[model samples]
Every structure is written in structure tokens, then in C-alpha cells.
Target: MSFQAYIDNIKAKTGKTPADFKKLAEKKGFIVKGELNPKTKATEVTNWLKEEFELGHGHAMAIYATFKGKTS
Candidate 1:
């Protein structure tokens, strides 16, 4: 799937947009000051999403990539 398609599917499944995930990640300390903390590991964030959001690995990675300002 395309990046946008993956993003749209995630939102449809979770009812949370990319912006919403950023806010949630901030509250969870994955992000700080509107940016992903440099020390944060992808596994940590992906594990959280897998546990809390029940997202698959790929989907969780998509969100993580989004945090890194990726669009592809």
C-alpha cells in the first residue's frame, strides 16, 4: 500500500489521525516539544502501539515514521 493508504487505514481503524498520534505519543513521552525524542527507540514506541493500540508491526512503524517527518 501507499504511505497515505497505510495512514488512512490506520486512522480508519484507530480513529486517530497522525496529529492525534503525535499528541498521544507526547503524553506517553515518545515525543517531546512536538518532536520525537532522540533517545526514543522504535521498538519502545512500536511495542506501546502494539500493546495499547493493538496495531501490527507495520502499522506501528508507519506511525513511528510519521513522527520522524517521513511521508513515503
Candidate 2:
């Protein structure tokens, strides 16, 4: 899916807009760097996405990739 599509999907799943998710991620220490930092493990981010947003793996990873600019 497209990056925007993934973001839209996240919003649909969590009832949170992209901006809301960005804030939540920041609170979790996932800095919004231009790219997915090598130090920022996907598993950690995934856990937060699941616990806080109740997102599935595919959806969580899609959100993560959107934040990391890895999706297109």
C-alpha cells in the first residue's frame, strides 16, 4: 500500500489521526527522524503500537514504516 494509505489505515484502526499517532510515538521515545533509525528497533515500536493502539502486525508495521519514511 501507499504511505498515505498506510497512514489512513492506522487512523481507521486506532481512531487516531496521523498527527495523533506521531505524538504517541514521540511519547514512546520513537523520535520522528527522517528515516527509521537503525537503533530504533521495529519490535519495540510494534509493541507500543499494539498495546496502546491495538493494531495488528501489518497495520502496526505500516504505521511504523510511514513514520520512518520507509513506505511508499
Candidate 3:
């Protein structure tokens, strides 16, 4: 599937946009001031998404990608 497809499916499942995730990540300290914290690992973020949001690995990674400034 395409990247946008992954993003769309994530939204359909979670009802949240990248901007929303960004805000939550900021609150959770995955990000700081719109920047992804260098000390944070992808697995840490992905695991949090998996546990808290019930997101599968791909979807969780997509959100983590967004934290790294990707569009999808």
C-alpha cells in the first residue's frame, strides 16, 4: 500500500491526524517544542502507540515517522 493509504487507514482507525499526534507526542515527551527528541528511540514511541492506542506496528511506525517530519 502507499504511504498515504497507511496514513488514511490510521485516521480511519484512530480518528486522529498527524497534527493531533504531534500534540499528544509533545505532551508525552516524544517530542519537545515541535522537535523530535534525539534521545527517543523509534521502538519506544512505537511501543507507546501500540499499548496506548492499539495501533499495529505499521500504523505506529507511521506516527513515529511523522515525528521525524515525514508527511506520511
Give the number of the best model, judged by lDDT.
Answer: 1
Q: Where does candidate 3 have its weakest 10-residue lDDT segment?
A: 63-72
Task: Name the 10 consecutive residues with the lowest summed lDDT in model 1.
Answer: 1-10
Candidate 3 residue runs with Cα over 4 Å from true position: none
Model 2 vs. true fold: TM: 0.71
Per-residue lDDT of 24 in model 3: 90
Query: Model 3, residue 48: displacement in angstroms?
Result: 0.8
Could you give me the TM-score of model 3 versus the true structure? 0.94
- Between prediction 2 and prediction 3, which has the larger lDDT? 3
The lDDT of each candidate is 0.92, 0.73, 0.89
lDDT of 1 by residue, 11-72 (tens): 99999988899999999899999999999999999999899889999899999999999976
| CA error at residue 18 for candidate 2, angstroms | 2.6
**TM-scores of all models?**
0.94, 0.71, 0.94
Of candidates 3 and 2, the better by TM-score:
3
RMSD of each: 0.9, 2.7, 0.9
lDDT of 2 by residue, 4-68 (tens): 77777777767887557667777666864534456789899889888877888888887777677
Poorly placed runs, candidate 2 (over 4 Å): 1-5, 32-38
Residues 1-72 of candidate 3: C-alpha lDDT, one tens digit per residue: 877888898899889988898899889898987899998999999999899889999989988998998984
